[model samples]
Each structure stands twice: as structure tokens, then as C-alpha cells.
Target: MIPVNEPLLNGNESKYLLECIETGWISSEGPFITRFEREFAATVGRKHAIAVANGSMALDAGMMALGLEEGAEVIMPSFTIISCAAAIVRAGCVPVAVDSDALTWNIDPTKIEAAITPKTRAIMVVHIYGLPCDMTAINEIARRHDLKIIEDAAEMHGQTYNGQPCGSFGDVSIFSFYPNKHITTGEGGMIVTDSDALADRSRSLRNLCFLPARRFVHEELGWNMRMTNMQAALGCAQLERLPEFVERKRAMGKLYTELLQDLPGIQLPLPETSYARNIYWVYGIVLKDEIDFDAAEAMKRLAAKGIGCRPFFWPMHEQPVLQKMGFFKDADLPIAAKLARRGFYIPSGMALREDQIREVAGMVAEVIR
Candidate 1:
């Protein structure tokens, strides 16, 4: 069966990994970690970048760096991965979620103002599936309310919004280097910021909050979420090829759109918007209401045809874990719910070839027909 996702590691990845092994700097304290952080920060136009064990930990560190008061509310999209909401809840802040836009499949900026309350301390805008949220509008709202912005740019490595990079807009932004992501370091994440204090605090938080002068003593609680030298080595290699990866993804998206543009009973992802072009991190398709089956059945049929597919994230409002905590109780977000049930993405990995894409598209057409 064709895989749903495959990373393209045809760069300096092996050379760097070998160098790390040869130098015996395979741990988190190696020079590669610092080098990777510096380069990544420059790449994103941020003053600082802190590498962590994984993307989830990056969110956790970023939320902690905010130093929000207990029960402070953070507004975010309900259509995002659990990590976004989990970080807020773990940081002792209440996560208030809004619905997603039907067109962009991103957080609806129009709904953000209504979700904001007196206790709201931050607005975490997740750049979902390589499509940026309306940051121009979101930033305006944040400025009016004095709320901090946390950008989850995990799916938008090289994506931009109105000429500005996604990570540059947030007070503390994050990216993941998971295998399925545009860049891969096996498992790694980064938190970038312009504020010196936030950067220092994020570093401390990820490293057990040990005082700079004293190694053993600690002033506050923190976690060991450091990214290893080996991981950073891989990241450096991946970073070098990010631009090319993004272009390849865009081309793949165009190819898919071209192949399936006239297919019935499906809503394809938009290729471009006025704010920014969709990077097509994954080529998602939302089955129309006229379709008889949900994404699960569609995925099953695709798999049978040797075409790999993955479903979109389940909305946070429907999660039993959050429901038990009384979050989003009685809240009805129709767009997120419908998309969750009907949306699934075909093979759009960077490593995917033209033939593979055509095969996948043909199989999807057959299955849907």
C-alpha cells in the first residue's frame, strides 16, 4: 500500500548525524543544538528559538512562559489537534475554543471576539493544514484587548501571511519537526519569540528552571524537554531544504487539484486566499453532505485500493476528556463537527512522486464514484 506520509531526507541529514556520532555529541548539550536554534530563529525572523523534545513540549513551554494566572482563559480553535488545548489546560489556563471557517478550514477570526472575556489572556492562532488564519484581523483584536498571541505554525513551516512569516506574528510561536511535517528531525519542536524575558523563561522552563548561577537549585517547577544534539543535527539539514520542500508541497497540491477538480461530492482545499497561498501541507478533501459515507468509510475504501489517507482532526469540543472537564459543554460548533466527520487527506507527503499522486487520485475517484 502507498503510505499516507513519507519524509524526504535526501539532504545533509546523514552527514550531520554521522558528524554528531563521530564527535560523541549526541546528547542535548551539544553545539548542534545551539547552532540549530540560532539558524531556526533567523529563518523565522525571531530573536530567539528554543529547541524542545517535541512539538507538544514546545506548546507546553510556550504556554508556561506566558506565566498566566490560574484559570486565565486562552481563546483557540476547537478544530486543532489536542496538543493546542492540552498545553493551555496543562499550564493552568482555561481553553476557550471557537469554531473553524468553512472556507479556509482555519480558526474563524469573526468568532474570536465573542469568545474573548475579561479573563482572556491570550489568543492562540493555529495555522491549520498550512493555511494561515487571518492574522491581520487577529492581531488587531489582540492589540485592542491586550491579549498575547501564540501561533502554532507546526503545519506552516515556510508559509506566510500578507508578506509576514507565520511565526513572526505571535508573542510566542511554535513549530514541530515530526516525520509527517514539512521538515523532519524524527521528533523535535521549537519555540520562537522576540521578547527576551519570554525566551529566557522558555529556556528555563524546558530545562527544569534551574537558576543560571546554580545548577542544582531551582526557583520554580519545569520539565526536561530538551532536544538532543542528534535531533538538532537532522533539523539543521531539514531547515536548509525547507524552501524547496514547501514548493514541492505546493506543486503536489496543484497536481491533486488538477486531477480531482471535477470529482463529485467533495470539497477540495482552497489553493490560495487573498491573505496567503495555501501551502497544501496535506491535500484534504471534505465529502459533501450528499455523500453517503464519512471519512472513516472513505479511508477504508482508499486503503483497500492501496491509497493511503488520514482523517482530519476531531474537534476538541467532542472529546470526552475535555467534556468530562465541563469544557465546551453544550457548545455546538457545526463547521468543525462536520469537517471532522467528512474530511480526510490523501497522500501529499513531500516524498510522493507524480505517479504516486496520480495513482492516489485515480483510486480516490474510483472509490468516491
Candidate 2:
């Protein structure tokens, strides 16, 4: 059966890993790791990029760098991976979620003002499915309220908004190097920021907050979330091919839109025109309300046809952990709930074969035709 994603590994990846092994500094502090961070910073146009264990930890570090007190609220979209909201909570901050926009499947900036309170400290925006949010409005709201902007740009790497990178918009931003991301380092993450103090703090926090040279002093609490040199080796190779990967994903997105446009009960996700270029990480095709299938049933049907399909993420508000923690309450996320029922992720992997994409489109059209 066709899988939702397949990380394509080129020959250079193995070569890099072998080189790291030959050097015998394969832990975390090697040439590859240093070069990876520097290269990533240059790629994102940020002053510093701190390599960490995973995306969640990068987010937690960013939150910690904010120096906000416990219970400070950080507003984020309800419709996202649990990690986005969970990181805020893990950082001793409140994860206040708002509704998502139906068209772009991004945080509805229009709904943000009401959620703001005296306790609000930050606004985290996810560039969902590589489609950018209304940064103009989100930035304005943050400016008015003096809230920090933390970009959970894990799904967006090379995409730009009117010539500005996604990670550049926020005070601090993060990217995941999971196998499914634009570039894979197996399991890795990086945090980018312009502030040297925040970068140093984040680097310290990820490395047990160890002092510059004194290794034995217990200063502020920290975690060992440093990325391994092996991951960095792979990251270096992947970074070199990111632009091509993004272009391939965008091409597939265009193909899917054109191939399935005439099919009934199929609706394409609206692209954000404000973004100078869209990087389609997970291309979503929203089935019409009249369709007989919810996302689950749709998946089962697709699987039966020897094809792979995934349901859209469940909104954070609908999660069981939120209810158990009493952190989530009734919120009007009608669009999120609706999309969660109808939306499912199509195979948009950069390495996905064109024939595979075409076959998947054919299977979809067969069902909805």
C-alpha cells in the first residue's frame, strides 16, 4: 500500500554519517553539528539556530527564553498537533487555543482579540500544511498587546511571505527535522532567533544550563535536549537539497489540484495569497459536507483501495488530555471541528513518485466521481 510519506535518502547522507563515525566525535559536539547550526541559521536568515533533540523541546526552550512566569497564557490555534499546545504547558505557560480559519486552515487572527487577557504573554502561529497564517494581522495584535510571537513553523521551512521567511516573523521560531518534514535528520529540531541573549539562554537550557566553562555549577534548571552529531550529519546533507524538495512538493500540490478539481465532493484547501511562495507539506483536500464519509471512513475506504490517506489533525480543544487537565474549555472552533471531520491529508511527500501521486488522485476521483 502507498504510505503517506517516505523520506528519500540520497547517497550523501550515508557518506556524511560515515565521515562523522570516522572522526569519532559522533555524540553532539562535532563539526557537523556546528556546521548544521550555522548553515540552518544562514538558510533561515536568523542570527542563531540552536539544534535540539526534537520540535517539542525547541518550542519549550523558546517559551523558557521568554522569561514568562508560570500560568502566563500563550495563544495558539486549536487545530494543530498536540505538541504545539503541549509545549506551552510544559514550559509552565497556559495554552489558550482559538478557532482556525476555514479557507486557509490557519489560526483565525480575527478571533484572537477576544482571547487576549492581562495574563496573555505570547501568540504561537502554526503555518499549517505549509500555508501561512495572516501574519500581518497576527503581528499587529501582538504589537498592540506587547505579546511575544513564537512561530511553530515546523511544517514550513522554505516558504516565504512577501519575501519574508516564516521563521523570521516571530521573535523565536522552530523547525522539526522528523522524517516527514521537508528535510529529515531522522529525529531532530532547531530553534531560530535574532536575540543573542535568548539564543544563549535556549542553548544553555537545552544543555542543562551549564555555565560557559564551569561544568559543575547548578544554575537554572535545564534538560538534555541536545541533538546528536549523527542527526546533524544527516541534516547537513538534507539541508543542501531543501530547495529542490520544496519545489517538488509544490509541483505535486499543483498536480493534485488540477487532477482532482472536477471531482464532486472534493474541495481543495485554499492557498494563502499573502505568502510569496507556498510550501505544501501536507496537502489537504476537504470533502464537501454532503459527502457520506467522515475522515475516518474515508481513510478506511482509501486503504481498501491499496492507497494511503490520513485524517487531518484533531483540534487541541477536542483532545482528551485537555479535558483531563481542565485546561481546555468550551470554545467556538466550529471551523476546526468541521474540517477535522471532512479533511484528510493526501500524500504530498517530496520524494513521492509522480506515478504514485497520479494513482492516488485517480483513486480519489473514483470515490468522489
Candidate 3:
């Protein structure tokens, strides 16, 4: 089967990892961790960056570092991964979700104000797929309301909005280095910010709140979410090749669009918006109403034809875990609900070859034909 994603590791990933093993500096205390954090922060135009075990943990750390009051409402998109909402909940805050823009698939900036109340303290902007949310508009809203912005740029490693970087917009922004991301450390994440206090708090939280002056004494509870030195080694190597990797992703997106443009009954990812071109983190296809099957059935058929597929995120409001919590009382996010039911992405990884793209395109057409 043609796998949905296969990361390309042609750079110095193995060489850096060998150095880590040879020097016996495989733990989080090694030099590569600091180097990686510094370089990554510079790349994203942030004052500081804290490395964590994974993207979810980075979100947890980022949210806690905000130090919002208990029960403070954080406005976010209903169409994001559960991690976005889970972090807010873990930090003792309520997530007031807004619907996605029908075209952009990012948070609807227009719907944001309606969800804001006196309890609202932050807006968590999650850039979806490869496109960024309307930061110009979102920033204006946050400025007027005096709300903090927490950007999730996991799917956007080398992407920019207008001319500025995606992770540079919010007060505290995050990036995930999962295997499928533009750059990967196997599994890792980062928290970046311009605020010194926020950076210090995030570092303390990731390391279990151990006071620097009093090593073992802890004043506040925090998680052990530090990324390993080996992961940082890999991250440093991957980060070197980020520019090329981004080009590869964009090239892959273009080829897929060219091949699948003739196919009916499905909608392709938008190549570019007014502000920025899509990096195409994953090439997603949403079935039109004429297609009588849901994404689950589409995946099954694709699997039967020796092609791998993955579904879009299930909306937060429809989650059984949150439903049990009595959230989303009579929610009405139709676009998100429909996208979840009909959307799935085919193979679009750095390792994918031109012939494989052709094959996948053919199989997709056959499945929907």
C-alpha cells in the first residue's frame, strides 16, 4: 500500500544521532537541546523556544504558562484536534469554540467576537492543514478585547502569513515536530514566545517546576515534558533541510492538484489565499454532497485498492468526552461537521515520488468513479 506519510531523512539526522550516542549525551541535559532551541527560536523569529516531549505536552506547557485565572474562557475553533481543547481544560480554563471559515478551514474570525464574554481571556489560533488563520483580523480582535493569542503552528513549519511567520503572531505560539510535519524529531514540540516571563514559566513547567535556586524544592506542580537530546539532534538536522522540505511539499501539492483537478465529486485544498500560499501539510480531499459515502467508507475502499488514507479531525463539539462534560449546549457548527464526515487525505509525504503521486491520483479517481 502507498502509505499516507513517509518522512524523508536524507540530511544529517543519522550523523547527529550517532554523535549523541557516542558522546553519551542522550538525555535532555545535553548541548544539542540548547542549540536546537536557540536555532528554532531564531528560525521562527521568537525571543525564546522551549523544547518538549511532544506537541500535546507543548500545548499543555504553553497554556499553563499563560497563567490565566481558573475558569477563564479561551475562544478557539471547534474544528481543531482535541489537544487544543485538552490543554485549555488541563489549565483549568473553559474553551469557547467558534466555527471554521467555510473556505479557509481555520477559525472563523468573524464568529470569534460572538463567543467572547467577560470570562474570555485568550484566543487559541490553530492553523489548519497548511493554511494560516486570518491573523490580521484575529490580531485586531484580540487587541481590541485585550485577549492573549496562543497560536498552534504545528502544520506550518516554514509557512508565513503576509510576510511574517505564523508562530510570530500570537503572544505564545507552538510547533509540533511529529513524523508527518515539515521537520520531524520523530516526536517533539516547541513553545515559542517574545515574553521573558512566559518563556521562563514554560521552561519551569516542562521541568517539573524545580526552583533553580533550590534544586529539589518545588513551589508549583509541573509535568516532566522535556525533549531528549537525541530528539534535539534529529531536530537540528531536520531543521537544516526545512527550506528544501517546504519546497518538496509545495511541489507535491501542485502535482496532486494538476492530476486531480479533472476528478469530480471532491474538493481539493486551496493552493493559496490572498495572504499566503499553502504549504500543503497534507493533501486533503472533501467529498461533495453528490458522493453518497462518508470518509470512513472512502478509506475502506482506498485501503481495498492498496492506497492509504487518513480522516480529517473530528470536531471538538461532537466529541463524546466533551459531550459528557456538558459542553457545546446545542452547538451549530455545520461546516465543521460536514468536513469531518467527508474529508480525508491521501499520500502526500516528502518521500513520495512522482510515479507514486500518479498512482495515488489514479486510485483516488477509481475509488470515487
Candidate 4:
């Protein structure tokens, strides 16, 4: 089967890893980790970047940095990975799901105002599928409410808004280094921000809340969320190739658009112009009601021909866990819910070649033909 994603390694990753091994600095405390953080901060246009064990931990640290009181509500898009909510919950905050815009598949910035309450402490906006969210509107609303904006920019490494990189716009932003990401370290994550306090807090938290490197000067309770030297080595190498990776992903997206444009009843997702680049981390397709095949049937048909297909993330408000909590009231997010039900993404890996794209395109046509 054509896999959903692949990690392309053209960096001096092996060399860096070998250097780490030679120096006996395989642990989180190593030169490459610091170098990775510094270089990444510069690349993303952030004041500081703190390396973490994974993207989820980066989110968790971001929430913690906000210092929300217990039960404080965090407004976020329902159409996002569970990691967004999981991180909020981990930091003793409640995840308040809001519907997103159908076009951008991003949190509806206009809807954010209504979700805010006296207890609402933060707003976490996710750039779903590497499509940039309406940051201008979102940022304005956040400023009016004196609310903190946390960007879950994991899937949008090279994406930007109004010339500002996604990770640099929000009050705090997180990036993922999983294999399928724009860049990878097998399994790693990073947090970036303009706030010195948040940056310092993140560094401390990732290293067990140690004061300037711990070693018995522990101040607050923290976790072992540090990224290892090995991960950093890969991350450093991946950084060098990130721009090309994004360009390749966009090229594939354009190809998919051409291939799928003529299909009746198949609605394609478009990138918002606000985004400097829409790197197609995954290509989402929505089958209209008039379509003969629903999302499930489409997936089954495609899989038979050795193609991989998957549905969108089930809206957080509809998930059984949240439903049981009675936390999910009438979310009024019709667009997001509908998209969740019928939307599915196909393979759009940067590593996928022209012939591979053609093959996947053919399989898609056959599935819904």
C-alpha cells in the first residue's frame, strides 16, 4: 500500500548522531540540543526555542506556562488532533471546543469571542493540515480579551501569515518532529515564544524544573520532557532541508488539485492566501452529499488497490469521553461536524513522486467512479 507519509533524510543526520555518540553525550544534555534550539529559533523567527521529548509535551508545557487555574477553559478548534485537548487537560485546564471554518479547516476566529468566559484563560489555534488559520482575526480577538494565544503549529512548520512564520506569531507555539512532519527527529518536539519567562519555564520544565540545569536546585514540579542528543542531531539536519520539503509538499498539493479537479461531487480543500505557503502535510477531500460514495466506502475501495485513506479527526465535542463529561453542549459547529463525518485525507507525502501521485490519483478516481 502507498503509505500516508514518509520521512525524507538527506541531512548530515548520521554524521551528527555519530558525533554525539563519540562525545558520549547521548542524553538530553548535549551540544546539538542547544544548537538545534538556537538554529530552530532563528529559522522560525522566535525569541527562544525549547526542545522537548515530543510535540504533545511541547503543548503541555505551553499550557503550563500560561499558569491557568484549575478548571480554566482553553478555547480551541474541535477539528484538531486529540493532542490539543490532551495537553490542555494535562495542565489542569478544560478544553472548550469551537467550530472551525470549512474553507481553511481552521478555528473560526469570529466564534472565539462567544466561547470566552470569566474562566477562559487561553485560546489555542491549530493550523489544520498545514493550512494557516486566520491569525489576524484570532490575534485581534485574543488581544481584546487579554487572552493568551497558543499555536499548535505542529503540522505547519513552514507555513506563514502576513510574512510571519506560524510558530512566531502566537504568544506560544509548538512544533513536532515526528517522522511524518515537515521535518523529523524520529520522535521529537519543540516550543517557541517571544516571552523570556515562558522560554525559561519551558527549559526548566523539560529538565525537571531544575534551576539553571537542576543538579539538586529543583524549584517546581516538572517532567522529564527533554529531547535527547540523537533527536537533536536529526533535527539539526532536518532544519537544513525544511524549505525544500515544504516546496515539495506544495508541488504535490498542486498536482492533486489538477488530478482531482474534474471529479463531480468531490470538494477539494484550498489553502488560504493568508498563508505564505500551504505545505500539504496531508490532502483532505470532502465528498459532497450528491456523491455516490461516502467517506468510508471511498476508503475501502481505495485500500483494495493498495492506497491508504483515512477520515478526519472526530470532532472533540462528539467524542465519547467528552460527551460523558457533559462538557460538550450545543457547539453549533455544523461545518466542522459535517467535515469530520465526510472528510478524508489521501497520501500527500513530500517523498511521493510524480508516478506515485498518478497512481494514487487513479485509485481515487476508481474508488468514486
Error of 1 at 84 (Å): 0.6
| Estimated TM-score for each candidate | 0.99, 0.97, 0.99, 0.96
Flag the better candidate by lDDT, 3 or 4: 3
lDDT of 1 by residue, 188-260 (tens): 9999999999999999999999998999898789999999999999999999998999899999999999999
Better of 1 and 4 by lDDT: 1
What global local distance difference test value does model 2 have?
Answer: 0.88
Model 1 has a clash total of 0
Q: Where does the lowest 10-residue lDDT sum fall in candidate 1?
A: 323-332
Model 4, range 1-369, lDDT digits (tens) per residue? 998776788679889989998999999889999999999999989989999999999998988987889999999999888889888888888889898887778888878898899998889999888678888888888888888889998998877788888898778899998988889999999999999999988887887786765488876899999899999999999898888888888889989989999988888878546445667888989988888667888888888899887888888888777777776777667888888878999987657788989999888887777
- For model 4, the superposed segments whose C-alpha errors exceed 4 Å read 211-214, 217-219, 271-275
Q: Measure candidate 3: CA RMSD.
A: 0.7
Q: Write model 3 residue lDDT over 1-369, tens digit each, in one string.
A: 999999999889999999999999999889999999999999999999999999999999999999999999999999989999999999999988789987778899999999989999999999999999999999999999999999999999999999898899978999999999999999999999999999999999999999999989998999999999999999999999999999999999999999999899999999999999999999999999999998999999999988999999999999999888877889999989988998999998889999999999999999999
User: What's model 1's overall lDDT?
Assistant: 0.94
Root-mean-square deviation per candidate: 0.7, 1.3, 0.7, 1.6
Q: In model 3, where do residues sit more than 4 Å from their true spots? A: none
Model 2, 117-173: lDDT tens digits are 999999999989878888999999999999999998898888887778778888999
Error of 1 at 136 (Å): 0.6
How many clashes (backbone atoms < 3 Å, residues ≥3 apart in a chain or on different chains) does model 2 have? 0
Q: Evaluate all candidate structures by whole-model CA lDDT and list the values in order.
A: 0.94, 0.88, 0.94, 0.86
